[model samples]
Target: DQQVKQNSPSLSVQEGRISILNCDYTNSMFDYFLWYKKYPAEGPTFLISISSIKDKNEDGRFTVFLNKSAKHLSLHIVPSQPGDSAVYFCAARDIPGGGNKLTFGTGTQLKVEL
Candidate 1:
């Protein structure tokens, strides 16, 4: 079974609006959560992240929220722009051992319309 899941395959929003993407996880050992945005032919770029110690983290127009008790997390983008259209992936990492490894959820494609 997949430890991380993004139930929604896609979402659409008009420019200058808020876009919300949701994710869920089954692993309690995960201590770090992150959101990454990817273009069609490029690798994913890190967006926002939240640690298990915090409930929320924000950077400019992007915000990430983590609910440790529910094993859920969400990403919110305010004033979504057309350039924001891309596949968003949720990732989680446990405490490090040999290396910091991440488990990623199936991505959610977001379409921003003008």
Candidate 2:
């Protein structure tokens, strides 16, 4: 079964506006959350992350929020630019499981329109 899911398959935002991507998980064993941005032919690159203990984490124009009780998380990009358009995947880590395997969501395609 797919433990992680991105409810929205795609999203469109205007350049210079805020872009919000959402994710939901069915597994409660996840301890860490991460967001990855992938371009056409390139591997997904780390964007921002948050620990389950904390509700929010911010880096530059990106922010990640986690709701442990709800098993939900979101990535926010402020003043989104065209360069930020890509497929974003939400991943969760089961730190207690020993191996560092990450469970990834299906991914959400974000398009920034100019």
Q: Which structure among the candidates has the greatest lDDT? A: 2
TM-score of each: 0.95, 0.97
lDDT of 2 by residue, 1-114 (tens): 999999999999999999999999988989888999999999999999899999999999999999998999999999899999999999999977735889999999999999
lDDT of 1 by residue, 14-100 (tens): 999999999999989888989999999999999999999999999999999898889999999998999999999999988763147
Question: Whole-model Cα lDDT per candidate?
Answer: 0.94, 0.95
**Model 1 lDDT-worst window of ten:** 93-102
- The regions of model 2 sitting more than 4 angstroms off are none
Model 1: number of backbone collisions: 0
lDDT score at residue 53, model 2, on the 0-100 scale: 92
Which candidate has the top score in TM-score? Answer: 2
Error of 2 at 58 (Å): 0.2
